[model samples]
Target chain A: MPGRGLNLTDLSYFPGCSLESSARESNISMMEAAEILGLNLIELEDWNCCGSSSANILDKEIAFSLAVRNLSLAPPDRPLMAMCPRCLYHLREAHQRLKEEPETLRAQERRWGRPISLGLSIIHFLEVLVRLGPARLQQGLVRNLNGLKFVPYYGCTLFRPPSLRQGSYYQGEMGNVLTMLGGVPLDKALTQRCCGSFLSAARADVVTPLVNEILASAVAAGAECLVTSCAMCQLNLEIRCTWEPRLPIFHFSEILALALGAQDYEGWFTRHLVDPRPLLQARELIP
Target chain B: MNPPAPALNLRGAASPIVLAEQDRYLARDIERLSRANLSRCFHCRSCGNGCPFIRGMDYPPNGIIRLVQYGLRRQALESHTIWICVGCHTCSVQCPMGIDIAAIMATLRRLALAEGAMIAETNILDFHREVLQSIKQYGRAHKLGIMLRYKARVRQWFADLDVGLRMLAKRKMDLKASRVKAIGEITRLFIPHWKR
Candidate 1:
């Protein structure tokens, strides 16, 4: 909504731990896509962990402090945008807690030696695109998707958390956006299934069947690939699936950048555990 | 109304639980922390039916809520369900009562840790510790470092070795961690007040 009336060209971007390392492709492609759309995403300087699930699980105070530190570092002039849903959730959740607990907010501000803006809006990239309107995306549309059938895998944390219910709901924005770019949105699948989250590391046994079920549902729905906004979901779907003829899991940004004619797709696709190039070539979206 | 389904084979289910043995405060504490009213759960099994990790859990999400409501502190804290839950909120969203079941699971896990209850899933806890440690050291998570430390602690070098190698081949796991500039500020947060 911040970009609706005003033409917001610049925003602060937080690309969490997953995108920063394991999911670099998601980060780079998102940057490329943003550039093509004339949106400048400035990375938050010295940004640390958003007090990931690991931190939140182990210690609440540390998690809250860690997230608050990121909020403290954000520039007050613009709305802060995060590509990772978990990062956005944690950041916003911490911000919400700060709003309710002004005393804790003051303590965190004093500790960080900086003032955090309670008015700073934390938004997801999908909401930004939706707010910018279809005309902006239509302007830079370089390559049609050739009607590539894909599942819009949102994973969890985007809309499921009650704390985030008041925020913009992004349930079908992926389908809406990709549909505009000549892609077929496959709705009859486990689009909102959990991607095994952190359990993928410690208990792959538990995550395997679950990931398999989601992938199986996608395949059953005749989906050729899965497009996910969460980088962790993208990675988990790719690495955890044991079934053959594995569907290539594309980060939402990768597909967007590809359609926008970002030339560095080879760099992104090569990093994928299950190669998406074959699927892309077969669809004739790639050379 | 549908007849109440038979209770699943949960911990301490062999013998009937004496109501007098109940902690009385367990449910109240969990409710306070999670902000989810356990009284609203009608045991429709929606949470259990929708849970992604239900197969791996000893008790379903609703079952855990039932345990807390009964004030079965040890059984609630020691159950495998708490650690198995990744807090995906699948159950929370599916609950007709608008109960944040995932938050309840998280609260149970924290209580279990604080009470030093036997962890049904030590591997998960170890993994979480490694992740937190990586965050503390670099002010951000270094996947390679976390995995290495996790592997060393779990003593399972060969487990998922292929996945690690594949990630390395793709350069997904960075050798060096991306760190915060003002690291002392981060490290200070880790130190307890008494230590400082």
Candidate 2:
């Protein structure tokens, strides 16, 4: 994690809920990226949910408890990375809430096998890649995404709950990586306006207009496609696109993997609720 | 000049008894959002820009411009929103036009049923009902039981074939947690009209 690029010999990972269910592309794309880069990501033998926005839907206690459970499953030394922002938010928020406040810390200290009073270095996958630098990504690229306008959509979870570190990091780092990958990273100032995350369930009617505003702006700005780091965003976007808009939505990792030739044109990419094949097909990038 | 509100009854099943304004737009009752929300739109076209799922729509969300302002209600209903909308409000929050597209959608959904608008994938509603039932039975979702039951209901048996095996292998889903809970208390949560 610290020495330039990921030393495959010392890398590890924890795939979160969004990838486990609805948005499965992130899982494959990241694996494909690691494989292409010769970085062997050792996935934990047994993993748990990061207790997304759902856990925090009402109270922080339930959210924190669920986050603690997932983190406890990780080994102490290796840094853990996740794709979904809600996962990122929960894990980071739980860690910060526990470490900063003693009552929370002491309570959590008793829960883990060895008192993990000092939090695990929970990181988002975006952090690992950006830190590796654009040069690292450039060396890994199989195709050039130059003229193909791209919109980087960081859903509510990735850049939200400003108090949380992991969520903040992905929001900050992915921009640099997008620049590094040689595509137009949408510079729209409100790029992180809550895509209403889990709010879609209780407020779909209110949310439809909200979703339209985002897609309209991205297209107006000349984005031919949008990139996301959260699985929920992928699921919500795919399910709600009832009206026509031709832009393809890609999990950030999948697009990066595709650019790096680590992964391209397969699996959930084919099963998307809305066909993103045109983007790939238009680019002659599809298999 | 503003056009007068359409004279369509938008009221109760063309009846022996006339209904009031509140009873109008009968379909809005089901989705719980209003059609007037759609009128505020001037088509600045913000929501369509940030949408991650824009590629799939036959109408593209920007058509909200064409839907409400132009009174393309029936045309909008027949679009995929009725079948695919999971009710995520990102569009509502992102709208610079201030149009409540989601509410417009809710109204459209209600109208679809009232007019018997070509009910596309009946599963969209069915999925919600099943999820509701699962949450009512357990305070939380019992993944296996719900998926199995939902799959049985929808006949999309092959969808996500990897889930059952994966959950079974992970041991996260247990059949025991799926007992139907205090039905009376949960059923009461369904009192008519206090809905979204």
Candidate 3:
């Protein structure tokens, strides 16, 4: 149970829709965090959507099939890890649906031209990191963000069609990891509130106010910065900042990487909407 | 092995809080709200702890769950709080509650709106639902379609132009395709979700 002593040798990783686009930080930082924790992420052999997108609103099968396809691609031994709530939602939800309805599973298998072995486990990156623990985390920090008030923005995936209770669950220790890394993890709200995931583009009108509500919490909590485990939530919260808190939103892993002593904050942290320089400058974590 | 019967603890109604006048312990439809299996919530506050909107709302998501458990029906339904819910539902995944706070929210939103709790500021939310419905109708969110409909109804019509340009420049918003290719074809392949 300790560190899962999990080998990085191979596994399928579902980075989610936004990871490739808006939330690249999760991707980059996860890489950094993985380095510190000694976990190797083998990108899945082949992948597609995790299914829970506005794209799936009209087509349920698109979301389910894509997730099934991704889950099916993982070799029998390695579990699949996903970073997006929606991806996790689709993949995990599909797993539950399949678990309950074997006939539905067979139909999809016949339709998609693939066989989904019912034995595979779908996991989240945050869950994996938590399982690995703070000892493994100690080796990951490049610099400790001592002064920044790191607030974790969880948003929708925390509760949804793919309920956390349903499958391989990840604990909310995402914030604990930040606090352990020598930063202030504010206990605040809207962490799991909606960041207007599907609404970001498809429904930008709803996105503004809903996202504003989340930002208001981070700002009011006196957080100098924010961190998140999900890629989509970060996208909404970062791009929609009004007063420009100038607080950089970080991927959970990136923060861990920084604390474990990673020197490349520029390459790692530079690509954010709300310039994290203020948080970094105030802390002297970087030159 | 026997599954844990859906648990219920409504003893709080004996107290004087008027919000508990109704059977608050029992959600209007517990079957739906409990889909995430909130019985699993250990109160670790992972979702609320991680929520970006933790400071603004009167009740964080976890508080809402506690409110639901206490049978504070009027309060939960009357909440302008859930109106601000952005539908992100991260608490569902992070939650040890494994509670689908998001789905509960979705149910709450329907109840809230039906019960008239969502009447505060119609501009943002109405347009938000409209956009989602448009995508639901078209199998994709055509940016131009979503934008025009949103602006026309909100009356500021074009006030969000700066945002559109920024997103487009960033490639976050697209102009060409109506839906992701093959979506309509695949959507019809699933089991029918019967509307009760």
Candidate 4:
């Protein structure tokens, strides 16, 4: 319903492991929202894992090589965009390392039998939205959020790491983008709290209290819900909280697509663990 | 319930840490590997205060730095602090000294694994192993498979069965893994030759 005649822009998208499997709703809604915004997110061919936190912990060599393999798969024409913050961090970190050590880059290129593009730009979906400007977003907006209050949760990986300090910081871009869509951003909450991450699987006891604290903060701030850019944060916050009247955790794209009046939202909303439909229905944004 | 134990007397006790047994190069090696300045940490405790999992860690982030600075190689490598960290970088961003505390923790974890130091938390290590195993086998993580293998390894099948079932009900965790067509490229990375 929005951006009916805008020229489409092509982007190479890396969904990573979480988005590809556990967070498929995020992937679908993100693609749907991008389509409305006239952004073509093409999947990279034969892409592998980003050598996640586990790989990075166990062996540095394997982690670097795994991330580099994805880099080799990305086409050099358009920028490579990722929805998952961890995947983006690993890819950019590997690229940074490769930039510093030309010999290692050459070795990786030789091993993969494909030339790794040193000039290829690695960007997040937030960066892409920011680059597209508020005017395009405003033009694409169909259903105004009707003053929906939400805590913009950027869980740990997007902009905190020291290795990524030199890169573009997207700390408040979520609030900025959501604000243009008539949503109220609640900044009083623990917006940058580390969402237990991989520890949720190994140590739920440690994660439960943390997730509860974050949700409690959002509740205390008078926020009706929480929006997060990372898929893992969405999953962790939804499943880890033991408190009653749990706040609905939304993937940033779901909210964005809903604003753009995407017709296939039922498919996406059905997959959410904490049902967001009640909140949407109450807001009168959806029927 | 018959006899009471006699009171023990303490006069002088030797400390467990002998200053002469310290590994002086421990700090330097960690700094080199992690590229973080260990000397910059003045025990500010900014990292520990901001750490979400500080309660889970035996020593605070700065305390681990203190252990490494003191050249307590065995203690530093064997401490629960390194294993408890999930590398969220909350400490790194909050550090006024520009020290990447998470990177230091990551380096310590690698060193601990390499030196065969006793892992403080075997369950966490087992989880990492399962995740890496899933990546190696399918090139992409299969959530169901990883969870099953991890639960099996930890020998706790019903630990988070509720959460697992909820995810299953929502179809969040797929039954089959999405595989990479060029699987050889991924499997090779797990081998030792890829390092060179």
Name the top TM-score candidate: 1
Taking all chains together, the TM-score of candidate 4 against the true structure is 0.94
Q: Which ranges in model 3 have alpha carbons more than 4 Å from their true place?
A: A1-9, A159-162, A167-171, A202-206, A244-246, A267-270, B1-159, B168-196
Candidate 2 lDDT tens digits, A1-287: 23233332345576764465445567888788877766667775445545443333322354466567556666666666666666666677677766778887776656444355253666677777766667777887777765567777876555434345233344556656766666667666346655645434433554566667777778788777777777667655654444586467788887778778754556746656556777777877665
Cα lDDT computed for each candidate against the true fold: 0.91, 0.58, 0.62, 0.89
lDDT of 4 by residue, B1-196 (tens): 6553321111121125557878999899999999999998888789999999987887788878877887888777877779889999999988999898998999999989999999989999999999899999999888999999999888999989999999999999999889999998888776677473
Query: What is candidate 3's lDDT per residue for A1-287, written digit by digit as tens?
Result: 21254553455676654565445556777776676677778777535445544434334455566567666667757777777766776777777778789898888777656778677777777777666767776655557667568787765565444444654444457777777778887867567666666445434555677667767787788877778777666766767656554467777766777777766767655566566766677688767
- Name the lDDT value of residue A284 in candidate 4: 97
Please give the C-alpha DockQ score of model 4.
0.77
Could you tell me every candidate's TM-score relative to the true structure?
0.97, 0.59, 0.65, 0.94
State interface RMSD in Å for all models: 0.6, 10.4, 6.2, 0.7
**Clash counts for all predictions:** 0, 38, 46, 0
- What's the CA error at residue B41 for candidate 4, in Å? 1.6
Model 2 TM-score is 0.59
What candidate 4 keeps of the native contacts, as a fraction, is: 0.91
Q: In model 4, how large is the Cα lDDT of residue A106?
A: 94
Which of candidates 2 and 4 is the stronger one according to DockQ? 4
**Candidates 1 onward: DockQ, in order:** 0.83, 0.04, 0.14, 0.77
Candidate 2 stretches greater than 4 Å from native: A1-9, A101-106, A112-114, A117-119, A165-172, B1-196
lDDT of 2 at B14: 21
Worst 10 residues of 1 chain A by lDDT: A1-10
